[model samples]
Each structure stands twice: as C-alpha cells, then as structure tokens.
Target: MSTAQLVSLTLAMLAGAVTLLGLVIVTGRALHRRRTRRDARLAADFRPLLLELTGGDDDIDEPLRRLAALDRRRWRAVEPSAISLLTKVSGHAHAALVSLFAQRGLARAALRDLDRFGAVRRATAAHVLGLMGHTEAAPALAGLLSDRSPEVRAVAARALGQIGAAEAADPLLASLAAGGGVPFHLVAQSLIRLGPGARPALAKALYHPEAAVRAVAAEVLGLTGAVETARVLIGVLAGDPSGEVRVRTARSLGRLGTPVCLEALIHATGPAHPHAVRVEAATALGDLGSPRAVPALCDLLGDPQYHVAHNAARSLARLGSGPAMAVLAETVAERPGTTAAGHAWEALAVLDLQAGQLRRPPTAPVS
Candidate 1:
C-alpha cells in the first residue's frame, strides 16, 4: 500500500474513536443536566398541587390527573430516565388527591390512581395508597411490611391496617416480627383498626415470640370485644410474662361473660394480682349475674382493698340470689361505717331492687 494511503487510514480510525468518546461524554452531561432540571420541575409540580389544596380550592383532582399524565407520558419519553423520580413525585400528588376524592365522594377515581401509581414502591406512594384504602394493592404493599427500611415498612403496615380489608391482615401479621420499637406499636394499632379483620391475626399474634407483641395483642383483642378471641384472652390470664398484659387480659375475659372464662377471672384475683384487675373481673361476674360466682365474690367482700370490697358488694346485689343478698346484708351489718359499707349503700342504689323488695315478691326479670 502507498504511504499516504496507510497514513490516511490510521488517522481516520483514531478520529472515529475520539468522536465516539466525545459523544459519550456529551450524552452523560445531557443526562445530568436533564436530571437536575427534572428534579426541580418535580418539586415545582408538587408545590402548586400542595398549595392549591391547602389554599382551600374546592377541588383539584382533575388538574392533578392531568399533571400526573404529563409525567407518565411526555416527560418520561424525552427523559426516560425520569420515570422513577416522576413516580415518587406522583405519590405526593396522590396525598392531595385523596382529599379531593373524599370531598367529591369519588371512590372510583381514588381507587384508580391508587391502583396505578401505587406500584412505585416509595413510602409516600405507600401512604397515599393506604389513605385511599386500596384493597387491591394488599399483595404488593404487604410485601413492604418487612422492607429493609423501617419507615417504608411502617407506612405499609399502617396503610394495611387502615385498609381494614381482610387481605391486609397477613401482611400486618408479618410486621409483628419487628422487634420492640415504633414499628411494633404501628403494626399493633393497624391490626386493632381492622376490628373484625384483626381477630384471627390477633389471636395468632398472642403466640408471638415477643412478650410485648403478645401482651399488646391480648389488650387489643379485648378492646375489640372479639368474642371469637376469648380463648386466647383466657389462655393469657396465666403463664404470660408481663403483669400488665395479664391484668388486661383478665378484665377482657371478664367482659366476655362466658362461663368458660369465669374460672380464669377468679384465679386472677389472687393477693398477688393488681387490685384494679381483680376488682374488674369480680365486678364483671357480678354484672353477668351468675349465682355460681356468689361464693367467690362473697369471699372478696373482705378483701383488703376498699375498691375490691365495693365491687364485690355491687356484684352480689346484681346477682340477686338469696345467698348474694344474705352475704351482702351480713357485710353491711358487720362493717357499716367502712368504705365497703359506703359501697354497699351505693350497690343497693344501683340494683334498686333491695333485699326487702326481693323478699316481698317473685318479680319478673328486668330484661
């Protein structure tokens, strides 16, 4: 080959290589510049929506929809790199959108946005989906309950609880594994929010390895009056590691008023027990108006705590059987000036059907 021909070929190859390198550098710079501009735009876009809603606009959901579409379609094309940033920005938009939908009573519209942008997997997006009560997103958000980030998992668990849909229980249940901290409280409250949806999960949670979780589960189930969960409450009355938890469980079981739980309540009233819990359980039995519990309550009439004796007297009056009446009359006669005596007078006022009234006639039940 000729020297000039070879030299021309060499220079042409090196030039092509340099040209390629220069193009890549320019592309990198373009991406950087575009990203910076897009972030600013996202913040700007979020501001108007936030201010408009907070400024008391009656409705801005329609406009928010248009704004979201601009990201999902246009900006995502010119800057395909912007999808993630845009999706996260869309979550803040949805938080505002929820209020508009509620004000307009547009359930369908709210669900649509949740089902769409909620897939972004950002904490803000999870929260928006939750506030919207999107049941369909349970499986997706449920996966976030153990997210490496506590904030993300907390939002997901909290949202599931608010959703209160049966589908969300499993994920909320999984959140119980979160050791002692804000996550535990967040998860427990969400399950409690479910009410009926939370019963089975709470019943299972009673057996959690963490005593704190188990204890909170019992109290929550009791507050929920999940009669179906009575067995768990009764079981926790004994062998539970925490005194506060057991005390609460006893009171809850007492409220259940089932004969099956009476034994547990009586057992919990031992001298070692919290006075408040023992008194509540005894009062609950008395309220149940069971003749069978008269002996135990009569025994408590002499309890060291004035409150205990008072509750015992009140329960005896409610039972209305001859033995309860006799036992109450004896206590009042024996200790007329003590606090128990004061409570005895109050008990008569409550039942209003006194020993004299019971003696006079076989009246029909009060219903």
Candidate 2:
C-alpha cells in the first residue's frame, strides 16, 4: 500500500479502539452502580438487626437467630459492617458477634481466603480473621506475613496480633529487615497487642541480627510492661551497637522502671553514648522515677549537649522529690547564665504554673 493509504488505515483502527474502550468503561460503571445499590438495600434491611444484636440493649436472641440464618447474598451484603463492628463492640456484644460469625462458618471461609490469589481477597480474609479474634486461624494468617503483596503482609501482621499469636512475634520482628515493606509502627502495634505473652519472644528478638527489628522489639517490650525483661533491656541499652537501638532500649528500660535498670540508664546518659541515646536515656531516668537518679540527672544538667541537659532537668522535676526539686532550684539560682540554668528555670516555671492551677477555685457552671 502507499504511505498515505497505510497511515489512513492506522488512524481508522485507533479510532475504533478508543470507541471500544469508552463502551467498556461505561458498561463497567453501570454494573458497579447497580451492585452498589443492591448492597445498600441489603444493608438497610439487615444492618439494624445487627446493631440490635450488638447493641446489647434488646433481646439479642431474635437478632442473632435472624443473622445466623441469612442466605449467602444477604450475609455478603452485611459482612463488611459486621466485621467493622467486631473491633468496636465489646463484652456480650462482642462475644455474640463472634458466635454469629462462627455459626455462619466465617472463620473457616476466611482461613481459606488467606491463600487466595487476589491480594484484596487475602487482605480482607486476614482482616476478618483478626477482627473475629480467631485463634485457630493464627498460623495461616502468620504465613501471609511473607506474602508477595505488601498490603497482604501488613494485614497479616495485624491479624496475627489481634489473634494474640505469640508464635508470630518472631516472624513479625524479622519482617523489618531490608526487603520487608511492612511499616515498623504496625509491627510494633501488633507486638503490643500480642501483650505480655509475647514477651518471651520479644525478649528473644532483642538479640535479632537486624537493628530495626531489635529496636522495635525493645520498644514493644517496654510498652507491653514486660518488667521481667528489664535486665535484657538494660544490656541492650549499654551494649547495642546501633545508636537508634540503644536509644529505644534506654527508653524501654525507663518504662520498665525497675531499679535494676538505673545503672544502665545512667551509663547510657554519659558522653560516650550518642547524643540521641543520651537524650532518651536522660528522659528515661525521669520515667524511672527513682530518687537515686537524682544525682546522675543533676550531673546531666551540666552536659554540653543541650537536649541531654534539658531532659535531665525535666527528669529531675519528674522525680518529684524534695532533693530533685532542690537541685533544680539551686541550678536556677546559682547558674544563671548556663544552659543547665535555662532548663532548670523552665521546669520550675512549669511547676509553679501547675501549682497555681491547682490552687485556683473551680468556676461555677452557667445556668
């Protein structure tokens, strides 16, 4: 064919493709709208019954029976709302919902969906299992932590936490290494949800090769109130090579607040440690709330590192002991031009403001 003829044919085919694409888009939107309307109708019909059952105010037996007997389409329509409430309701309402889900075989179905090829299906299943608090599905959910999809991994991590799967703690910590796309905050939250039962695992994670994992494990240990792991955290605070990890460890030790951690936290505040580590350590000393920390914290007030000295003064105030306050007062009076004095003045001013607020009379309500 001649060049002009070939070009004209190409344009004709492009026009036809564009027209076909527009038709497909219109058809897809039409179908989605229809589906949405159907879902809305179903939700309106059934969601009230669910609310009544979960509300714990009325007779739940009737609502529970109706929900349990729902046909597949109706159940599908209401499933999202039910799952959404799983995390919100508690006491009898929460228990009733779990029983309803089990009677409907949702737990088993969600377990199967965990292995589905679609990422959304896998994530949704993980979410359902987690919300249902299905302990039996914990292992399957744990497997999804390493799934190819980042979202699936995140959902799986969350589910494992909700399920209280202590076994999954190690894997959750490991996911923080190089290629694990899961957010560190999510992992930490899950570990915390796992509670003290995961402390043994979290304590074990303190020695993990990855610094990120170690840091998270240390922080979660403190948040979970794993006072038993104070020694472990103290060691981490003193010897961990990563400054970030050491900082977290010091903070955790402070939260643990065992007197055993005092030497380690004080040592961490020394100039030998990183500035960040020293700052966290100084703050942690206040959290420790030990009068013994008074001397070390007073010394920290003199450190050239502004943040370290600043935190030290605050920690001294937090100690709330006469000696600690005396140090702050003396620093303010004797070291007027110094960094220590500035921090001391701020702490004393805050104390005075708090005292004034306490002494103020309560305002009567307007009629």
Q: Which of the numbered candidates is closest to the native, going by highest TM-score?
A: 2
Per-model C-alpha lDDT, please? 0.66, 0.87
Poorly placed runs, candidate 2 (over 4 Å): 1-17, 57-59, 353-367
- Compared with the true structure, model 2 gives a TM-score of 0.89
Error of 1 at 337 (Å): 3.1
lDDT of 2 by residue, 230-288 (tens): 88788887788999999888888889889999998888888888899999999999999
Predicted structure with the largest lDDT when compared to the true one: 2
Each model's RMSD to truth, in Å? 14.8, 6.3
- Scored against the true structure, residue 196 in model 1 reaches a CA lDDT of 86
